[model samples]
Target: MFYKYETHLHTSEVSLCGHSTGAEMVRAYKRAGYTGIFVTDHFFNGNCTISRKLDWEKQVELLVRGYEKAKAEGKRLGMDVFFGWEYTHNPYGADYLTYNLDKEFLLAYPQLCRLSFKEYSKLVRKNGGLLVHAHPYRTAFYIHYPPNPKVHLVDGVEVNNAGAGSSCNNNHMAWKLARKNPRLIRISGSDIHSTEGAGLAGVAFRYRIKSSRHFVDALRAGDAYLIIDGKITDQEGNPVKEVV
Candidate 1:
C-alpha cells in the first residue's frame, strides 16, 4: 500500500488567508483519500492573522493553535499528523516549509524570521530538521523582484506547487531547476488556503510514513513521487500513466 500526504496546508485558526479551520482541514484531507497531512500554517512573519504587538511567547502560543488542533484530531482518527510552519523571508514573499521542528523550538528561537537562509540552514541542521523552499519561483506582489533563494540553503524545493498554474507560480521552471540540481529533493504541495485548495497536490510513498522523521527521510532518499490532478505524475508534469 502507498502512503499519501499533503505536505503544505493552512488553517483559518492561524493563517488569515486560510478559509477552513484546522479540524475542518484535517477531515477534508481524510475524506479526500490522504493518509496524512502537515499542518503548515503561516508563521508570525508571513500571512499570519496573529497580532505582532503581542509578546513573543504569546505569539508562539497563538501560532501553534492550528497545528495543535490538527494533531489532536489526527490522533483521534489514527491519521498521521506532522507539525511544520510556512515561514516567510522578511521583506520577500518567498516561504519555507519547516519540518521536524517543534513548538518549543519556535518559542526558543523567536527571531527565526530575521535569519538569512544560511543562518536558518545551520539552525535547522542542528535540530535535525528539513527546510524546503516553498514556491521558490513565486514573485512577491509588493516586490517586483523574483525570488531566488540559494539552493544550498534548502534541502528540497517545491517543484509542483498546486497554487501555481499557467499564469502564476513558475512550476515548470521550478521543475527544471530541481531536475538539474541532484542534491535538492523535489516536492509538491497544494498550498491550501481554502477547501477548494485541497486535493490538488501532495506526495506519495511506497512505504508507510509513520512519522515526521520517516517523511523527511523518504524525501531525502528520493523515495516519494508527486501527486497531482488526482493522479501520480513526474516532477516535469508528465503523467505517469500508471497508478501507484
Candidate 2:
C-alpha cells in the first residue's frame, strides 16, 4: 500500500505565484510520477492584518477552474487531483490544504482574524475538511511560527515543504513539539509554485490512496510516510525504500 502525492501547490490565479495554470502543474506532476496533488492557492481577505489585497471571489473562481483543468489533465495522465486553498492566519501563521471547501463557505467566512484556532478548526471539521500547516520554518517573507503546544489544534503539520528550504529543520522541530500529541498527524508537501517545484516534496502513504478523501483520511489516521529525494520513511525514521 504505497501512495505518491504532492499535497501543496499554487497556480497563477494566486497573484503571488509564478505558475500560470493548473494544467501546467498537472503535467509536471504526471512527469514526476505523482499519484495525486492538492491545488492550494492563496486565500487572503482584503482586510487582513497582513495587508495583502486579494479578491476572494476571483480567487475562488480560479481555484474552481484550476481544479477542473487539473482534473482533466490528471484523468489523461492517470493521476488524482484535490481542490484546496492556503488560508492565512495573519502576520505569522497560516494553514494550507483546506480540502473539500466550497466557494460559499470561503466567501461567508472572509475574516480569519475573527475566528479562534479552535473555532476555525471546528468549522473545517464540521464541513468535512482537512488542514495542513504550510512551511512552518520559513520566516523571511511570511513569518510563520509554529503553533504553541498549549493551543493544540490542526489536523496535521507539514514537515517537508520543498519551496521553503528550511522546511526540513521546521519539520524536525514540529516533530519534536508534536510527539506528545497523538492527535496531531505528521505529513509533508512540496508547496510547489512552479513547474520545476511540483514533485519536489510529498508524503508516501503506507496504503494506496486514490482520492482527496482517502488522502485526508490517511493523514488523519496517521498512516503515511514522507518522501524526500526518493527515500520514503515514517516520522520515527523507519526506512521505506520501495518507492525510490
Candidate 3:
C-alpha cells in the first residue's frame, strides 16, 4: 500500500493567507484519504499571523500553534501530522518549504529572518533539515523582483503545486528547472490553504513515514512518488504504478 502524505500545508491559525483552521485542515486531509500531512505554516519572514511585536520565545510559540492544533486533532483521528514551515525571502518572494526542523531550532535562531539563503541553507543542512524551493517561477504583484531559485542553496524544488489558480504558480517552469538540475530533489504539494484544495497533490511512499526526520531521509533517497492532478507519477512526472 502506498502511504500518501501532504508535504505542504498552511493553517489559519498561523498563516494570514490560510482560510481554514488547523483542526479543520486535519479533518479535511483525513477525509481526502491522506495518511499524513505536514503543517508547513508561513514563517515569521512570510505572511505569518503571529505578531512581530512578541518576544522571540512568544513568536516561536505562536508559530507552532497551527501544527500543535493539527497534531492534536490528527491524533484523535489517527492521521499523522508533522511540523514544517514556509520561509520566505522577502521582496522577490522566494519561498522554501523547510522540513525535519523543530521548535527548538527556531528558538535557537534569533537572527533567522536576517540570514541570507546561503547562510540559512548551511545552517539548516548542518542541522539535518532539508529546504525545498517552493513555486520558483511564480509571479505576483507582491513579488517585486524576478524569479530567483537560489538553486545552489536548496536541496529540492517543488515541481507541482496543485492549489487553486495553480496555473499562475507555473508548475511547468518548476518541472523544467528540476529536469535541468537533476541534483535537486523533486517534490509535489497541494499548497493547500483551505479544504477546497486538500489532498490535491502529495508525495507517496511504499513505506509509512515514522516522523519528520524519516520523511527527509525518504525524500533524499528518492523513495517517493509524486501525486499531481489526481494521478501518480515518478519524480520526473512519468507514470508510476499506484497501489492502495
Writing each residue's lDDT as its tens digit, candidate 2 over 113-212 gives 4777668778887888877666555555555554453225567666666664533566666666557666766766777767875565688775667666
Please provide TM-scores, in order, for all candidate models, with all chains considered together. Answer: 0.92, 0.81, 0.96
Name the regions of candidate 3 deviating beyond 4 angstroms: 164-169
Candidate 3 lDDT (Cα, 0 to 1) = 0.88
Best by TM-score: 3
User: How should the candidates be ordered by TM-score, best one leading?
Assistant: 3, 1, 2
Better of 1 and 2 by TM-score: 1
lDDT of each: 0.82, 0.67, 0.88
Predicted structure 2: lDDT: 0.67
Q: What's the candidate order when arranged by decreasing lDDT?
A: 3, 1, 2
lDDT string for model 3 (23-140, tens) is 9999998998899999999999898998888999999999999999999999999999999999998866788999999999999998999998789899998999999998887777
**lDDT, candidate 1, 1-244, per-residue tens:** 5677899999999999999988888888888878889999998878899998999999999988998898898878777878899977666667889999887898889878788767988998789889998887876474343555678888899888888662254887787778878788888899998877577689888778887888888887878878876677665556675443
Model 1 gets an lDDT of 0.82
